[model samples]
Target: MQHSYRQLADLLSKEIRAGRYQVGERLPSVRSYAETHHFSVSTVIRCYRYMESQGLVEARNKSGMFVADWKIQNASADKTTQGKKQPAPPSVEYDKLISLQHRMTELYSLTAQPLHLGLHLASAAPQWYPCEALSKIAQRQLRQQPWQIGDYPTGTGLPALKTGLISWLATCGIDLEPADLLITNGSTEALNVALRAVAQPGDAIIVESPVYFGLLQMIENLGLKAIEIPCVPGAGISLEALEYALEHQTSVRAVVAMPNFQNPLGCAMPEKNKKRLLRLVEQYDLALIEDDVFGDLSHQQERPLAIKAWDKSGRVIYCGSCSKSLAPAFRIGWIAGGRYQSRINSLKLSSSLITPLFEQAVLAEYMQSGALPSHLRKLRERLVANIPLAIAAIQRYFPAGTQVVSPAGGWWLWLELPEHIDSLALLRQAVGKGIAFTPGTLFSSSSKFSHFLRMNIGRPWGREMEQGIKTLGKLAAELHV
Candidate 1:
C-alpha cells in the first residue's frame, strides 16, 4: 500500500513528467509544500528525498531541490510518431492460420496436455476480482428486475448498460447515444457484426500488420482480404502507410484498428495518429472498425482518447468490451456503429438475438457504482507489476539477439527472436515442456512474423511462471542453435 509520503511523491513525479515542473526548476521548500498539501514537514521532506532517489529531482547543499533533467522511460507515444514510406502490401500465406483452426477443433480430443493459447486470461488474479461486491450487485439486479430476464429484449440492449457505457467512455473522451450503440455477445461478436455490416465477399479490409488472429480468422471466414499495415512497437500503425492503402486500394471496405493496448504488439497509437485516422476515414470516404476492448487496461488510470472520439461524419465503428477489465464470463460487449448502426443492430439480433439481460443489468449497476474504479485500480496494478518481471526473465534467459517490447499497457509481451528461429517450431517444442505461447504466425495472415512470439505475462511473477518462461527461452535457444 502506498503511504502518504509515497503518494505525494508519485503525484509530484507525474506533474513533472507532464511538464508542470520544468527541468532544472527549483521545487518548493519542504515547509511550504507541507503547509499547502496539509502534510507534515517531515513527510514532505521524505517525498522530496524519495523523488531525488528516483532521479526525478535533485538537491544542492544550500539550495532547495530541483526537477531533474530526466527522460521518462515510459514514453510509448513518442516512439512511433515518425513517418515512413510503407512497402506495398505483401501476399499473405494463410496456411498457418488455417492450421490454428484445425487444432482448436481437435483441442478436446487430444490425449496430451492441450496447448493453452494463454488467451483465456490468467493475468487478473482471483484476489483482484471484486467477487463479493459483484455477487451482491448481481443479486440486487435480479431482485430489482425479475421481469427483465423473461422479457423480449430490446433490439440494441438494456438502456442502463448503454447509459453506463456512455458515462464510462466519457471519462476517456468519447460520447455516444443508445441509438449509436449495439450491444453484442462480446467484442469478438461485435467485430463479426462490424465486419458483416461494413464488408461483403471479396472486399479488402486494412488491418495492422501482425494483427489480432481473431480478426484475421473472421476476415478469412467472411471471404474478405486484409491489407496489412506495418505497426511500430511504441508508436502504432503507420499513418502514411494507411493513407497509401486508402489511396490505392479502392476495394478496401473498412480499416480495423485497436488504438489502445493493441493485441500482440501491445502498443497505443499516439493521439495525433488517432485524429489523423479520422481524417483518413473522411478522405477515403471509407469506414473504420475500432477494437478497444483493452482500452480500460492501460497502465495509467487516465486512458488515451480513442479514435472514435474524433469521428464526426459517422464513419467510425467503435467497439468496447468489459471482458478484459471486468468479468469475462459476463460476455458483455458493444459497438458504436456511427452510420452503420442499423445494419450492425440487425446483424446482432440475427446473430445472437440479445445479450443476457441479467449480465447487462448487473454490469450496468456495477459500473455506475464506485466499485468499477477500485477493481480497475487493482487489476492495472497487478498487470503493471508483472510486465517487468517477464521482460527481465526474457533478457536473462533468451538467446542473444532476442528483442522484447515494453508495452505501455496490457499483459502480453511481443518477443522478436533471431531470424533463423521459427516461432511456430518453437511453439511445438514449448508445448512439450508444458509452456504455451501464441506464435507470431498466428497473429498475421502472412508468414512475416514467423520469427516472433507473443508471451502472456498476465500471470503474476512466481517460481513456476518464471521457470516456464525460462524453459520457453531454453527451447527457443535450442531452436536457434
Candidate 2:
C-alpha cells in the first residue's frame, strides 16, 4: 500500500479506537479532509473508498461517510478472542456525557473575548510566565534528538521529571519515593485516575459544599454521588460535618479535598484539622484525594505542610501541579499514591499514554536549576501585593453588605453577595461589561451558592481590573432593585 493511503487509514483506525469515530459516526467531508491535509481531493476520495471496500466505513447520500457498525462488532470480536474485554456500552450521548468539556468551553469563550476584569484568571499574566526558559530547554532537546521527532511518553512519564518531583516534595515534608509518583496531564487527570482506582459508579463520596467546580464536574461525570458537607471559608472543611457524613454514609468510598489554598476559596486547613482528617480517613477506610495545585502559589513563603505528611497508613492520594506557579499550558502534574501506586500507574496507562516527554524533560531541568523556586518566590511576592489591591477594590466598589474572606494564601478571593442577587445573573451582566468571574452555582451540584462568586486575584490589580470590579458592583446594585 502507498504511504499516503496507509497514513490516512492509520489515522482513521486510531480515531475509531479512541471512539471519536464511533460506530455510525460521520467522518469528515472529503473536501474538508483534503483541505486540512493539503492533499488532492482525489486522494481523499480514494482513501474513503478504500475504507468502504474494507467494510470499515459506509457512505450516505446528502450526508457523508460514517463508521460502519460492523467495524465495531469486528473490533469487539477481536478483543474477546484476545482475552480482552470490550468497553461497556455508553449509557448517554458522548457530548452529554462529558459535562466539564462544556463548562470549560464556556469559560474559555468568555476569556477569549476582549475583557478587562476576567475574574476566571487561573494564573499570572502571560508576560510573567517563564517562556524563555521553556523555549531554551525545548531547543536543547531538539538539538540532541535531531532525527527523532515522534516518541510517545509511556504512562510512567519522564523518569528525570519524576525524580525531580520526589526531591521537590521531600523539601515540603512529603517523603515519597519516585516509585510512588505517577505523572499526569495535570491535577485534573490525577484526580480522575485516583477516582477510577478507588471508587465505582453510584459510590457516595464526601465533598466540601461549594467545592472546586472542576472536581464537582468530575464527580458527576463518573456517575458518583456527592454528600456535601458545610465548609468554613477561612477554616477548611467542617471536620464535624465530615465525620458525620463518614459515619452515616457507609457507602462513601472516598473524600476529595483541597487542604491548602483550595480552589475558588483559597482556604487552607489548619494543621490540627489535617491530622484529624487523616485519622477519619483511616477509621472510615476511605481514600483521600488531596488536590494541591495551588499549594505552591501561597502568598507567604513559609509553605504549609501537605496532608500527605500525616498519611502513615498510605490511604492518601496526594496530587499537585505547577499550573499556578509555572504555566497552565505545561500540563505537567503528578500524584503520589501512597500504597495504591501501581493501581494508579495502571490507570494512567489505560487513559492516556503520558504527558509530552520534551516538556517534562525541560521542567525537570528547570527544577534542578532552582529556577522553579526562584520563579515561585517572585510569584508569591506579586500575589501578596495583588491580594490587598483586590480586596480594596472590592470594598470600594461592591455593595455595602457584601462580605469577603481575606485568605492567608493563594490568589482567589471568595465573595458572599446578598442572598437576593444571583451570581449567575451577575456573571452574565459582568460579561456584557467585558468582565468574567466564576459563578458560585458551578461549585456544587445543589446550586446553593447562587449569591457567591470566586474572583481570581492572580493578575495584577490595575485600572482595568479596578474598573471592572466597579462595573460588577454597579450591576449587583441593579440586581438588588
Best by lDDT: 2
Clashes of each: 1, 0
Query: What value of lDDT does candidate 2 attain over all alpha carbons?
Result: 0.78
Instruction: Name the lDDT value of residue 126 in candidate 1.
Output: 51
lDDT of 1 by residue, 15-96 (tens): 9989999998988876678789899765776687677666677754325577866674224324653532222111112123
Off by over 4 Å in 1: 1-123, 140-149
lDDT by residue for model 2 (374-409), tens: 888888898899887888888898887899888878
Error of 1 at 74 (Å): 58
Highest-TM-score candidate: 2
The TM-scores of all predictions, comma-separated, are 0.76, 0.77
Number of clashing pairs, model 2? 0
Q: In lDDT terms, how accurate is model 1?
A: 0.78
**Regions more than 4 Å wrong, model 2:** 1-112
